[model samples]
Target: MDTTRRQALTLALASAAFPAASASAAPRPTGVEGQRRADLGDGRFLNPVLAGDRPDPNVLKDGRDYYATFSSFQYYPGVPIWHSRDLVNWTPVTAALKTNIGNVWALDIAKHNGRYFIYIPVLVDGDRPLRTYVIHADSMKGPWSEPIDMRIDNMIDPGHAVGEDGKRYLFFNGGNRVRISDDGLSATGKIEHVYGGWPIPQDWIIEGFALEGPKVLRKDGWFYLFSGQGGTAGPPTSHMVVVARSRSIDGPWENCPHNPIVRTARRDEPWWSRGHATAIEGPDGKWWLVYHGYENGFRTLGRQMLLEPIEWTADGWPRALGGDLSRPMPKPRGGSGGAHGLALSGFSPDMFGTKLAFQAPRGNDYLDRVKLAGGVLTLKGQGSGPADASPLVFVAGDRSYEVTVEAEIEGDTAAGLVLFYNEKLFCGLGLGPERLHAYRIGQEERWPPGAPIDARRLHLKLVNDENVVTFFHSRDGRQWTKERSFEVAGYNHNVADGFLSLRPGIYAAGSGSARFANLTYRARGPSA
Candidate 1:
């Protein structure tokens, strides 16, 4: 064998054996992994049932299939729809709304009569006017129709309910209701103040009188309305789930004797600021409630989807079964089939339409920024860094995982993978002309001993364990070099306040575009 080839092989083996030699070493835990609450399938499940940054869950059950969507907000490919057979496990089915409608908030997903409809509430620029838009699809996996502006201004969180008169209506925030047209396409009548929300005690430390997230259900001649109050953030005890019910769809609603059905009464609890719930009957005919909450100190994970079994009292009021939601309760029974979540580690050329999505762009300009071929993704550079580039990202549920992608900068531009949280707060490492740039908090710092890259192809990897992130790069895909590491526990809602989580993403920014290839992702446990 040639001496040069033998030396290269020896170096590769040495780097693999020594952690210091390989720059792409996995990150150590930062103590946040213990808070997750999903069935890890290891005879144990984690808390927060749905982890990461999922918030404002709206769930719909179609026959045995259950579909759920949450507030996508600034994230494009708005209205991501998830499917599940058992309420416990969920997987992304499709991103329902592709067109940029506006900054989307809490939405309602329901199947009325025969069609599936999502009532979206968005804030348009001019007056900061809140409008609800309607989109329908024949099937959950949809060729969803374009959004029809309902023109119902100054309202949010549209909950669909069928009245006793066999007519459709929408219950919105601020205790308001509007009658819907027969076809459920548009509004027919004026919005009216319906029921005043329940009041909380004055001495109880809370956020504010934020009457929001009204969800309705018709059960046994009674129409039940579930609403959240006391603002979404502030004190840990703020943001609670409250209920009121009435026999008729219209008036004289009675508040639940136990008005606040679920709340974080104390800060010591594992989850904080719990509210915004949707209730449903489980497959076993048992009652269940799905809601959102910030996990203890890990507010950076955003408000995650939480599942708890509900039991009805003889008097017909509902109660939560999962205590404080910090511990595992009994899993719901009788759910037999369906997958949980899409594994993002592996990708083919066709992965974009399924497992991968770009962060929602303001305009449609970023749509043409990416091209996939032969299992590789080539992304054109945009913005100057992660913030403006609208980095291509995927939601990762694990608390600890590593993602690596092969990248080749075509011009004087730069490209790298990142854990991005909006434009202002993000951190990652990028390669530019003869130097490596380490970014944090919207600012870039240069790293010494950077690799010289005249060639177009380079491999990059990021390992985010808990909130800590580390970056690495490779030239020949064998030997590696660590670029920089950062602790990002504060890149979350409490500090940044976008109601978003720090997400795993890739960015190509600077002068020219970059071609990315062979993206590989892996979830690591304590051992890894």
Candidate 2:
């Protein structure tokens, strides 16, 4: 076929896979402007109970309250705990991992012996030779213990379960299992293959048969192993949830008659690759499934956590209630969480005191490198560029928000605000000693010659109006010039494969130091 024909065919497929929003329609509200809330306020809640990059959900039911956490890859202060009582409304409780362990993936949060534990498997800086680690806390709002490397090799997701025999075990991808110690801190027995996951049809168009993320639930004299298959993120149709049941936790697992309890059969669905679910009994004793998926055309938001009701058949099988989940359903009955989600507005009176966390650093030294005093944040520059500089970053869950910061470089340093996803993918406008620097898709691009850069102090602003980021700069706080604009819907795990979220942050690169001030964060429009 000719190049033109091939390109046209590709475009057709792309359009079929992801339907574009109508041009004449009003802009859909994203990020926290009373939009994307799972609680619909009419006793009907939406599918995505929690939105924005919350993947590999592990939900634990503790008394009347429910605690949940996601796989926070490469984000320091990882595994943020969220609390919800009604299961529809959630609020961020606290971040558990303060120190960087690595790129965390498919973690399991469980309470064994009245103590909270998060079983983590990470790539250790996105390198090969994966390892599993465990962290524990006395309280959910922790004082979480430092990560203790379990040293388990070649594992991605660790699903913790206690057998009827009262022994703890972790089920992994590729139908593997390993025994855990009595304290749930270390692996005990040899890793062995136990249950072969439910087989996907050979003709199915899937990314891969990578059966992973086995969340085990033991109830009614049966051990239900819920596993995700067809790869995590690739084609929109890839990734799904399949269930297998067994009388004994050891062996002889049978696939569910209604296999694939949840899946994105079509590419055009609102939520794609819907899998990795944690089946939990809601506060009212009704069973529900919480999973993650990429919002259609908004992959940069990462896989937002989704909640759907489930029903059990008389013959002992679970079925998902809400279909495709493009709309709202009845809210979960019973208790209510105090509030759901965080306020996106971070603008404070004092810019120097802004809550900041460095990107995944090699060590704990980044804290010492940052100093705040007299309304200025002095950060020592590091790395050849932003990818390794460990730019100070914070999580913003809004779909449309603007952030601005005034930065002054000391010596050879170049510093400015950025919309960063990870080391591999990011874009923004910055200033150096000589000229303006533009970063796109993890690489620095040449700017137009003769852009003004005489003044040492530069004010940089990033307006992310629903993934469309516009860059602006100003010498004085009053006058601003638009530098550039770029759409960043692809800077997420589906394209970059980092399982990360697009975040607004500040970075200092090259030698010397950079002083940043007047940092402000405010949510913008889907104008009414």
Candidate 2, 1-528: lDDT as tens digits? 011111000000001100121232222222332224566567887666776678888899999889998887766657778888888888777777767767778899989989989999988645556999999989987878999988688888999999989999988989999999999989899899997888898877788998998999998999999999998889888899999999999968999988898999998788888999899998778899999988887777778889999999999899999898976688878887456544433232222112345678767555677775654567898987889888877656456667776778889988888889888899977768878889988988877467566645677788887788899987655568987888898888767777777877888888888877656555555420
Instruction: Please identify model 1 stretches exceeding 4 Å from their true place.
Output: 1-37, 40-46, 343-354, 446-456, 526-528
lDDT tens digits, residue span 96-129, model 1: 8778878889999988779999999998788657
Question: 123 in model 2: Cα distance from truth in Å?
Answer: 1.5
Report the Cα lDDT for residue 512, model 2.
84
C-alpha TM-scores of all predictions? 0.88, 0.87
lDDT of each: 0.75, 0.76
Q: Ten consecutive residues with minimal summed lDDT in candidate 2? A: 9-18
Q: Relative to the unseen true structure, what is the C-alpha lDDT of residue 402 in candidate 2, on a scale of 0 to 100?
A: 72
**The CA-based lDDT of model 2 is what?**
0.76
Output the lDDT of residue 110, model 2. 89
